[model samples]
Target chain A: SQKIEQNSEALNIQEGKTATLTCNYTNYSPAYLQWYRQDPGRGPVFLLLIRENEKEKRKERLKVTFDTTLKQSLFHITASQPADSATYLCALETNNAGNMLTFGGGTRLMVKP
Target chain B: DVKVTQSSRYLVKRTGEKVFLECVQDMDHENMFWYRQDPGLGLRLIYFSYDVKMKEKGDIPEGYSVSREKKERFSLILESASTNQTSMYLCASGILYEQYFGPGTRLTVT
Candidate 1:
């Protein structure tokens, strides 16, 4: 069976510092991966998507790296602010699964002032 | 911007009652999905529709069913609600890859 794992523990970081989150998978090869932001009591909002062929992608102060060989993806938020606090989710879809998205448990991030 | 809307933000239902959660997307996407979110469990797909009247079972479809009579609307039906069915329900619409999510409905079965 395929499994997606994200750090279940909350990540606390000082404001203006970089926050790094990790996502790992096992027993599956995904064609694409995605990141989403979820505030408390709200649905997730799409943030970024990285294809298997893409090594890195960036938007504003955020960046993502995908290492297919390691079966891991790293999400980075640079110059983070208090407003950047939220739970971040990682999702992926394999070609054999008919493009259905599988999401991780998510890692809650708290940016301290 | 793409918009997906769920019928209710919160709901309370009694066990054994029939419950319906509705979702509508304005983007005219080809795919719609239903998912449930529980603490530490992540998002579990309940069902999905590729087109009107076309449906597929996701990983967790045992206690739920779905209806897609129109392109913009998808409904999840709980035939006989149970306490274990209480959770946050989310609906999403997308094309080939990116998906837009609704605010979600928090259903509580008592």
Candidate 2:
């Protein structure tokens, strides 16, 4: 069985500061990893995704780094704002498997002014 | 843009009632999935469909069933809704890579 864990604790940071989120996995070799943002009472929206062979990927203010050796992926948001306060989740999946995605518990980010 | 639309935002049903949760995707995706989101337990996969009329069980499919008579629609059914089933139900469509999720449906079984 595959297991995925994220920073279960809520990350509280001051507005305009960068917030870093971590995702770790064990027992599975995922070919691709993804990140999503979910607001309260809403479904998750896709943010970024990187393959196992890729080291880093970035989009606008968000940057993601993947280390296959460590089986970890880091998501970073620069100059975070109040609107960025939400639950961010990481997903793990393999190419051999169908399009099934396994998600971690997610880390709640709270950006306060 | 791809859009996944869940039938309802919130639903309240009693125990033993048959519940139907509907989802539709405009992207003509080959994969569709249903998952339950609970606090602490994270998201648990309940069922998935590879194509129209093709279904597969997931990790938590014991109490749930699914239907996909059309390519654009997938439905999750609870034969006997239980109180334990009260949680957020999410539907998603995938394109062999990333998945696009609907707005989610909060179901409460009283």
Compare the candidates by TM-score and give the number of the best one.
1
Candidate 2 segments whose C-alpha is farther than 4 A from its true place: none
lDDT against true structure, model 2: 0.94
Question: How accurate locally, in lDDT, is each candidate?
Answer: 0.95, 0.94
Residue B53, candidate 1: how far off, in angstroms? 0.5
lDDT of 2 by residue, A4-113 (tens): 99999999999999999999999888889999999998889999989889999999999999998999999999999999999999998843764888899999999999
Cα RMSDs, all models = 1.0, 1.1
Model 2 residue A97 distance off true place after TM-score fit, in angstroms: 3.9
Residue-wise lDDT of candidate 1 within B5-97, one digit each (tens)? Answer: 999999999999999999999999989999999997999999999999999998899989999999999999999999999999999999888
Looking at model 1 chain B, which ten-residue stretch has the lowest summed lDDT?
B92-101
